[model samples]
Target: MIVRTIRVRTIWSVCVPLPLLSLMLVVFGLTTGEFVIAGILPDVAAGLAVPVPAAGRLVTAYALGMIVGGPVVTALTARLPRRPLVTGLVAVSVLANLGSAVAPGYGLLLAARFAAGLVVATFFAVAIATAVSTAPEGRQASAVAKVALGMNLGIVLGTPLGTLVGQHLGWRAAFAAVAALTAAGLLMVLRFVPASPAPTGSMRGELRVFKGRDVQLALALTAVGNVGVVTVFSYIAPLLTGVGGFGEGAVPALLLLYGAGAVAGNFLGGRLADRALMPSLAGLLAVLAAVLVLFWAAGGVRILAVPLVFVLGLLAFAIIPGMQTRVLTAAGAAPTLAVAVNASGFQTAAAFAGWLGGAVIDHGPGLRSLYLVGAALTAAGLGIALYVLRRDRRPSPEPGRRPEHAGT
Candidate 1:
């Protein structure tokens, strides 16, 4: 029976990580919904009998829901047990996807997407905060990495999987698949995650973190970074086909390679952040800027697309854990609200990027300009990081001003 016991132990090891993975799946659902337009825009337009551009507005509505829900729900549920709150949010997400799958008209599907985005916002905020709070201090990066894997998972799997489902099934089938995944994820969250202790704080107390410059800078950095990345990434399929001359079938393979690279970068990023948080961040942003420029140059070469996509994925995602660490560090003791707000900022940035990308596509500049825009935004974020680093290097102004309260 020793062999049987060992197998059980191995299974537990795998199961222990399920709660974290479940959160990522929730993220995957959100990301998939956000990106569904990429593959299903035509189908949705055809189905709804609306213009493709009008169908794209569904993405906008979804992002708006996420942006609005993140901080509002975090603030409202500050005292709720995170596990239950998160599980409930996932349930909402499942319902939203189900609604999208069954909706009779374009307007109803649009509304459903917005509702799903709302749950996405709240779930992301609570999950990240609780994961960080429960983690052992030194292992915070690893803990955060577990959850951040959701972003990578969403990036790697969400689009391709959603597209595949849409292709084999129907556009509505895409939402049906998302709904099924959400149900599975919610069940896992309920079964595997331990109860989260409620925080003892007023909304005012949690809001105090915003008064700190470092916190503000960190939020700005997140917003800028996300906007930059999504601006270009929102049109990735188009870029591959229009510029890279890749066939439709080849896009998913390229995305999968990028996802694999992101997973590797995420581990390295977490480790390096644990070792040297700030410098690792600086180097990462630098790499991000470089990668965007390289992407622009190689946008047309199918042969070079693989390595460039890998590098782009790596540099873009590697910054996530460190950024989370930075924010938590700056937010002082109560990190839940800060984490939630960070998510809000990220979603807002996503909304901005989507709108910007759509505008570029509409105004006749073509998809290639997205890379230029993304590169510029990355450079701006890098500049912000460098400024923070420079200021951190200086001595405190007063005996009281000694940077002790600085968090992220």
Candidate 2:
């Protein structure tokens, strides 16, 4: 009887985090829909009767929508109830993906992709805020990590699978698959997620987070870190093919390794942040900078490049939970809007980094220069992190008020 009781308790302990699990699934579905386009661009171009380069614009459209939409949605829906809001976001994802699957032309497809992007960051902000708000005390970072785990899994599993499906079935089928997964996520969220009231603040109050130095610093840190990551990642295929001398077949396996590393980093980062947020963040950034430097130096050696790619992915993502936690903690009363804005910062950085990387490729530096650029960006981010840490050490103005440092 005692053995059975212990077994039941163990299962319950694992099962108690199902809300996070649901959020993960939702993230996975959304991320897959957002990223799968890269894998299916050729098919989309063929089907829409547009040039492949034109099809590439679908990605840019999505990023632009995410950049513009996240904060707007958060501000406009600041007072809406949480459960229905999340469910509605998933519903929007479902409908948007369906639109993508069935759209008849390039213009319609672009609209669908943009519409999908519009909700991606907003969903992340709300879902992450919900995850943190509902999490057990002392486990907020862990909850956020679990949510990110789904995204990593999507990168590891979903994009490849979508590509395979698009290769065999059709690109539209890939979007249809995304819609189906999103529908399942919708049902899970509606069934399992508990309702929470929105934070009691006006749009003006939520907007006030921008004025906080710590909040602005956090956003800058996220942007700098992401610029470092995306600068290489956006052009990883070319770097591998051009610099590493890797064949097309090896790219997927290499990316899988990176994704696997990301999964490990996600969970580890959350645990570390839960323990010592600022130090963990600083350490992760330092490691990331070092890895980027290593990648730049050894990119031509396959054995070295493969392992460094994994380490690069690990260090790159390990900072996410810490960054999110910092913003949320610093923002105090405006967690949702702060998170939304942070997501926007990341998207904007990704767009900017891609453009910068393209310029380097087109100009004299060539593809190998991307890693160097990435290293420089990460080093800059580390400097910002160090500055933030220094600021945290200063004494607070109020006698009883503790400084709003990273973890505390």
Pick the lDDT winner.
Answer: 2
- List clashing residue pairs in candidate 2: none
Instruction: List ranges where model 2 is wrong by over 4 Å.
Output: 1-16, 398-408
Model 2 poorest 10 in a row by lDDT: 399-408
Per-candidate RMSD vs. true structure?
3.4, 3.3
lDDT tens per residue, model 1, 1-408: 999998987885664366677666667666776676577888988988999989888878887887787788777887887777777787788888889888999889889988888766667767777676666778777777777776777666787778888988999999888788777777777787778678886778888778888889888878886578778877888988888899999987888887898988887788888888778888888888887888788878877887898888787778889888888887885577777788879877876887798998889577887888888898888888888788778777776565664654
Error of 2 at 367 (Å): 2.1
* Model 1: CA > 4 A from native: 1-16, 245-249, 298-302, 355-372, 395-408
Instruction: Give the per-residue lDDT of model 2 (tens digit) for 40-95.
Output: 99889888888999999999988888888888887887888888788777888899
